[model samples]
Target: MEESDTTKYVIHAHISAEGVVERPDVVGAVFGQTEGLLGADLDLRELQKTGRIGRIEVNITSKYGKSSGNILIPSSLDKVETSILAAALETIDRVGPCISKISVTKIEDVRSSKRQQIIERAKHILTAMFDETVPESQELTEAVKSAVRVEEVTFIDNLPAGPDVLDSDAIIVVEGRADVLNLLRAGIKNAIAVEGTNVPQLVAELSKKKTVTVFTDSDRGGDLILKELLQVADVDYIARPPEGKSVEDLTQKEIIKALRSKVPVEQVVEVPQRRRNKQQMQQQEAARAEQNGKHEAQQREYQREYQRPERPERERGETPRRKSLRRMEERQERREPPKEQEQQPEARKPEPREAGEFAEIMKDLAGTLSAKLLDANKNVLQKVAVRDLANVLKETNGEVKSVVFDGVITQRMLDIAAEKNLEYLVGVKMGSIVKQPANVKVITTE
Candidate 1:
């Protein structure tokens, strides 16, 4: 028999006989009848000789001329070959002069069973080893303490808040849930989050009862949120994270320092007012400068108009009413030889027809909320909704020479027009444009 270590499959069979049958008879019948039943590769005698099949064992009991027993065979062959060998054992019809029947009950893969046992044992070994290497008393205690502190986080009116927010005399309002958690970690148990730029009603109501400290990030968004809260909520103090930093990223020491240096709400509120006043002053100065420029332009235009030389009066004979007048005028000119027939100032040149055409087109588009693109010949290229004007212009590839829209001319529209090198832009109103290009003429209805 081969050792169990080399065996891969175990086949179990039940045997029965009508009359008494011994164990040796059953074993011999199994080997003899099943011999050559399969091919030479699966022959029981050959397989056993090559150590592919293990020894066959038979156990029996007899009672009143009837016998029943079991047969066991182990194989190193694959499952299909093992199953074929086990089936062949059922062909043993007679065991030493007694009619017998054999049936294979089960075929077990030995390695699968061993693998399950190995996995369970490995789990036990790893668990014990891990337990031995765990943190010591103080380290474990601190870990538990930190976990408890984090668990103290609660919610107030759908906003992340600490467990003691309602009971605390002072409350710290932060930007988001992460900031709230960071404050909690630092032992500040009266913190809450507005969650975003919008100030919540609960926060506003709490501010009326408790002293509120608005702690925010140091970015533009934080400043905007602070302004929003100040307008709606009764904030008492304001604390800001370090420049270019966020409340959620601040360490405990940094958080404490910022809180300690917080300014009163009145001081923070005055900062924006002072900024607005400065901006208004600058705007007033710019308005004066622009007015001066327009006044100078008007003066230059008047000077040019009046400085032109006037046309000399014609003599009597030069009058177009009669040939006699012409003859008389020529005679007088011959007599005096008027100093260089003073060149008549050229008739003031008429306004370009294209400007009139553009005006008519803009008048038609007055309340239509539509735009027209014109080519160099004053022919309409395409008309589109004012909202789609910018996109259409971008696609025109400089084909459009002018744009007339019944909408506000915004800086964005101006930028697009400049890129396309448009000649003229006409709209109902003009937006706050910080800069204007000299090449493109911008006109408004009012």
Candidate 2:
């Protein structure tokens, strides 16, 4: 046979995996090992460009026979052909739980033809390989007509530009011209239609070549399209709107939302089976019952323990106003001593202020301190200290905002702030210091 007329160039190899299928890692390894033999560059771009190396197809079968797929290589390159076959044979012997079946398929040698015919045939094979079902005459003719009518856009041909062309975060794979138009209307341009099960060789290459998300409709036809894609394409995400919804059926808003909510590839591959409402409710009840039992056990444990008496309140470490008043009383008492026996300064204390007024005072003080604020509820900043405020701001690189206090700020607050070198302390109310640590902004005002 003339080199151009040789029809025995395609080699077919079936590889069976030990479990569900060969791990992607193994598949990649096999590809890597045989890259020299197949005459393929094997990089994503080249794999996409050449579609098939020769007539050789590497078929993968799962141990359970539950899943299978194929990889193709062109056979025209003699060196690649020999290397591919040898590598396939070697891999069959060495890989885990995998057996390789090798064979060859004949194709009409159409070499020496015009460039356009060669391109057309190559494109046809890709679409055919990825398509789950070949359309009968009527559907086939219609698809061709639709594709022919498609308008071209920059970096795209025959598809409209409704999807923002610049967005590269996600990709959409669909079927046919009408579908592409619909997606465009929905303002989803990150999409490419297969134009039939015969996804163009270019589309097939792109699917494997890009970080893609597949979004087909919820019908058998759509399912077929997706199957074809999953079989031959490397997709990272899958998105589906409500059942009975097609990409064409979605409004622009719906399209954007659906694309944003694309499910991860693993989720798509292993869709969670739905449980009945009754079963779900039962599971919830069991969880609640377990929680209740734990709570009751905790309560019983608490009841078994004895509580300790609280210490007597002291004046020196009391509220600031109380501390000042107590000091004055102490002076008077010391001056009179035993003569003022009935006047125990502690017993003749001023009336206590309401919690609200105390909170207001702390808030005012916090405002004056001008520290970076953290989360505050009821005016108490969580995990913040006056001494650390300045440092925290500096560490955050000056993103700190004003700090406010609406709860009792204690001596511990001052200690922590000082330790951390934060600036500004604001409190809803102040307590008498065991000792006011030096050089910390401690403000307690309304």
Candidate 3:
């Protein structure tokens, strides 16, 4: 066999004959019987000549005038061809004598077994290589340098602050302790956190001594903190993360970019004041226009109420005009009943028992941290993890009558429920949902 034909399959067969048979007879019968079975492409004669099939070996023993032995054939053919060749060997009925029987027992793929051995050897080699290597001097030096640069975190006035706050000429004020660590990682060692929305007194005092740059998140909460900081401290400059990002989450490059883009406190205060003044003017104009409309409506109402002539004193001779007005009033009274009837409210019907039952079940499930979907008859269609509730809600169609989950009811969840025309969402808490759909009722346990 050539080197390329090293990976071949081994076919094992059992052969038996009633008359005594020798090894050569068994081999000859196998070759002659399966020669034309699978056509020329897989013919055992042509395949053996081309080195695609290896030598066939036979071992036989004779006892009591009966012969039985094993037959082995190796083939470099692919799986389908190997299987066909193995099956054809079973058709050899008479091998050089009385009725013979052959059965192909197994066909083993040699390459798969070799591949497993190679994988185990490769793993061993890699592990040995890793174990033999030691850390170089340069790697040790880099490790030491990194350790030195890890600044120690300390507390100042009960707020987390970096080690270089006292020594540095300028300080960066951030929203939380994580922001302080991030800035430190970025090589800005003079960062400190106010810990919360409220500015600490020590931070205000530090602002008076050092050049303080207030770095906050780029959200509404950040703006509120900035306003409070301005009221309580003498801030020099203001920095903010990119829109929709938090200070703690900014990358080193982003942190540097934000710091470079810092604006003077004067500009920050003036722009917001201008915006506030503009908003106040718009509100005042809107209020004035509304008041004017109300005044016009009231004037029209007064005219309608007082323009009618009072009954002329009976002492004076009743004028023809007064008699005509009195008849008109009597006709108007007859037309008012239909309008009053239209204004009366219709009676309300009782709610479905299923909905009430579902609500009760949901109330009992509060704080369970699981989600359940209900059908029209209040049967639970599915129960799922609360974290997967949003995705499940998106894929479900209108068959869902209500969704009860032990999680916060967010606006996104509410919107999806509304799209499916879902009637009720009972949860443990509610998020800030600005625009609630009128068709969906949101209920919270707390």
Candidate 4:
């Protein structure tokens, strides 16, 4: 039997002879029986000559003049030819002049075994050599954000705060340094921590100047801190974390939602100056300039409230608050001499018919996110969406007189309206308006 290394399949067969037979007799019987059984394409002699058929091996044992053994033939032929050659091996009825019987046992795929070994070897290499230190994109982003926030956090009045705490028009007051850090991580640059339950005098003064919202955990400590701030500082609103959660534990989304859903400080805790004791009054006192600014802000706030009558339903339970605010306004008024009050000019509001027309247009445009340009006679000169209102108004010559929309009126829109010499502007709500057009009257639905 010849030997060849490029083998893909091995055929095994069992042989038994009527008389004693050796391995040579068994190998010769296999080749000779299957020689012409298949065509020239699969001839065993031709396959062996081309090295397509590997060595034929046999193992035998002779006992009591009887022989039993197994034959093995390796082939690289296609499956159809290999199976046919295997099947033909069973037709051998004699082995080299001896009556013999042969039966095919099994065929093994050499390549399949090699493939399994390759796979197990690859697994070992992967486990031992590959790098596993790479982190996910989200984790990398969080790490970079934490580093940047740590750099931007500053100290205000020796209390931890975001960089913009002193400059922003609105500020958030939290419980501790950790809460301030969390707010900084959320990209809120106007947050400052009180550091404890005792409200600092700086935060109280800031409350008198800028809008202040007290934000804290929803636990017992938070409630006590909120009460202390309400008594000592002029807080505008109160924002609480979720039940059983601390401010530092809130995610960015939860923090934003809590601030957005904040309630007015008066609604959360009503403390009428008329009802407060002398000590509480002393705690709530401020400098004369702060008092003046606070009174003017209150007057403007009440003026805006008077323009929108949506408070009629809420007036029942707010009587004490209303009286308190009224008394404060009267005291501020009496302090200002008659001459200074006369010199201060007030902006004129829209006329009843024109104001009603603007209100009607605003009501009709509700939820539409659209705007309308009106002529002097309340005629719609042009209609555009709120997003394009400023650009469209800028392009118009002077045909547009009044503007009405179902969106919040911003200061930029007001400036554009003033440039266009528009007479009146009306919107669903008014945003922070620092600069008012002296000639143009601005009205809001509420």
Candidate 5:
């Protein structure tokens, strides 16, 4: 009992005696009856002396000359030893001259209960006691990817460029090293820099062999560089940042938008040259003003000469002056031709009629849960409910040039439309689309 603190298991039993018995009688019966029943090694007395077993506990109740109660015994012994000792106790049949019966019930392991408590506490500590500032796996992956891409800007022929420039069929030409780094961040690797307004020979040679797109800052310098590159290099296309936005500062979405909206070189050549025309117009206006000033002085002298008081018949014959005035008017008519209209800079072709027609079709189909497929000519070739859009588009040939619907354009539908090579997608709104095709146009009301 004094060594009970080392106990690993507790034994429980029910004791029933035919005759009334006290606690002392029950305890005595257990030891007296079980001693030497198995072997000397498992003797209850020896186990107690060795602190392998604790003192036995007996609770008794007396009613109608009968005793029935429970017994508890603590054991420091192993599993088999404890069970053998508990079973021997059941052999007790007499308690102070009365018939008795003991039934071994159950054994509870103390270590197991303690281990369960520990597990519960550990769960609470793990959740409530730790800092939660750790980022998600996806966020960490994105951060590392961005870092790697930004560091991958390499130099080719002393020009800052991405490593993929030589291998890719088409290359993007930017103004400076920063623009190349920014394009790398957007996962566009085939980019090289011009480094200044003067187009580099390396870029020009490469442009002649491979397709080039000159992307630059959204300012006068960018435009000037663009025009210079246009003359020196074989630019297949031209891409520009949005108004007042730098290419290096554009987000991935904006970068893709600019690149997708790139127009053919033919469509862009006259644009900058129009500014050249404006300069020429300014110079012509200055020359014309100088000539007009000279003409005004001459006119003042001619009027003074004509106003001189009555001259002789020889000086005024039919007014040698009136005929001379007629002749001067004839010379002026011959010198200056008809005043022509000043040429205005031609604007880029208006927005594709397909966009406006799509918008109108979208408005008409709104709230009707319907979709319209149009050919390149803005003629509706087929109309169907929105639910059947995917199946219909799949079954149709590549002749369907555009799609306008009354519902949101989800990623699934967008992919299907793109896979079918549809040119335009006009919807009431757009859903969370992860992949946007560059060739396909997406439009939403809001």
Candidate 6:
């Protein structure tokens, strides 16, 4: 056998034949034998038939030496022929060498194509099965995450009604689901709750649809929540009760009173300047006047007694006690009256200056008219007729931005008031047309 590095395996042979076997024919024989042994296809005929092939060399050893060494077989048949060949080689080496003996050694165990193809097919099937099932739900979960949208909105289940209650010309925002329920129980119908600090998208949209007011608790948590909301929300007002008070804790009457007495958020931030108590001051003045009146009456009586002439008594059996009493009075009259009594007013302190103080009186009106105009219930406000504005103005201590009327005002009326520069005429009912004043805004709310 010729040794070559390029071949995957080498088989060395000491053939007792006359000439070398064809290398191609030997290769083919090896292939055919392996095919039969390993249940595969192996073509080995090319090596065995070419008798003059130089690919394999036949070395004849005349010394008749016994050869022994370890040979490595091809990977495919390494395990299959190892034990059989090892035992055979051991048995052959022990025999005498003079008699000719056939010895076999395998250096390669090449495999055929058919077996490898079957293994590859099995791997492909396993890979395909894995690909089909693992990620089915994963894709759906990702799409669900991507497709849906959530928005923030103030939500409520109910509300209440009354003049003292806060009305919703602007939307009212509260704290939780339960607070909204409580407000509804108190008869405030146009209220919504924030539910939490997270302003939902729906609530945000509704706020834009109407003016918004944030009504929260008076504590730190409520303050924090309010701060977060105001940072992003378009709110028109804030209504906070006394610190530590919650809407849920307020009774219906407390709710009404708080609403009726609510101070604007802007005003809340300013220094407190509530007026001194007028009723108490007035009561004190009245008492002072009454005390002065009693003193004056006593002073007048003392003066009358002093001016009366002393009368001589006609002595009878009792020695005229009146004369003695008159003399005693004369002596008493020489003593001065108490200083307070001497200084007392002649009549009840003239009623406090009542005239030319209309402006001061108007300042004390209970509710501001202008604030009511701006802050009244949208439903009730929308129904206020123009004629009614005058009465509202008289009743309110606030200013009116514009007057809304039920019936029409004629061009004559506009002409009369043209010099005043009124900007608009708003009516809930139909109104007569006023022409030629192009700058005036006129709207009918019917």
Model 6, 203-247: lDDT tens digits are 566554566667777665576766666555555556665433577
Could you estimate the TM-score for every candidate?
0.31, 0.26, 0.31, 0.31, 0.30, 0.24
Provide the global lDDT of candidate 1 against the true structure: 0.77
lDDT of each: 0.77, 0.51, 0.75, 0.77, 0.78, 0.44
Candidate 5 local lDDT, residue 91: 78
Across 47-110, the per-residue lDDT of candidate 1 in tens digits comes to: 8998888888888999999999888898887555787888898888999998999999998788
Per-residue C-alpha lDDT of model 3 across residues 1-446, encoded as one tens digit per residue: 22236446888899899999898898888888777787877889998888878888888899999999998888876555787888898889998967999998888677777889999998997677554456585687589998877676788877888888988889988888888888888888889898777787888788767888889876656767877887777677888777546787678999999899786654323223443454579899998999999779656755554565756554587654566566557755876463332332211222565346656766766544468998877789998756457778889978998888766676677788899999877676555466677788766554
What candidate 4 gets wrong by more than 4 Å, as runs, is: 1-151, 272-446
Ranking by lDDT: 5, 1, 4, 3, 2, 6
Candidate closer to the true structure by lDDT (higher is better), 1 or 6: 1
RMSD of 4: 29.1
Misplaced by over 4 Å in model 5 are 1-149, 270-446
Query: In candidate 4, what are the lDDT values of residues 293-342, reduced to their tens digit?
Result: 97798888776656553545455665545755666678678885645322
Pairs of residues at least 3 apart in sequence or in different chains that clash in candidate 4: none
Q: Which residue runs of candidate 1 sit more than 4 Å off their true CA positions?
A: 1-149, 271-446
Q: What is the lDDT of residue 279 in candidate 2?
A: 44
Where does the lowest 10-residue lDDT sum fall in candidate 6?
267-276
Model 6's number of clashes is 38
User: What are the per-residue Cα lDDT tens digits for candidate 5 across 264-334?
Assistant: 55432322344346457889999899999989977986786577665575555656567557766776788
Which one wins by TM-score: 4 or 6? 4
RMSD of each candidate relative to the true structure:
29.8, 28.6, 25.0, 29.1, 30.7, 41.0
Candidate 3 residues lying further than 4 Å off, grouped into runs, are 1-129, 132-149, 270-446
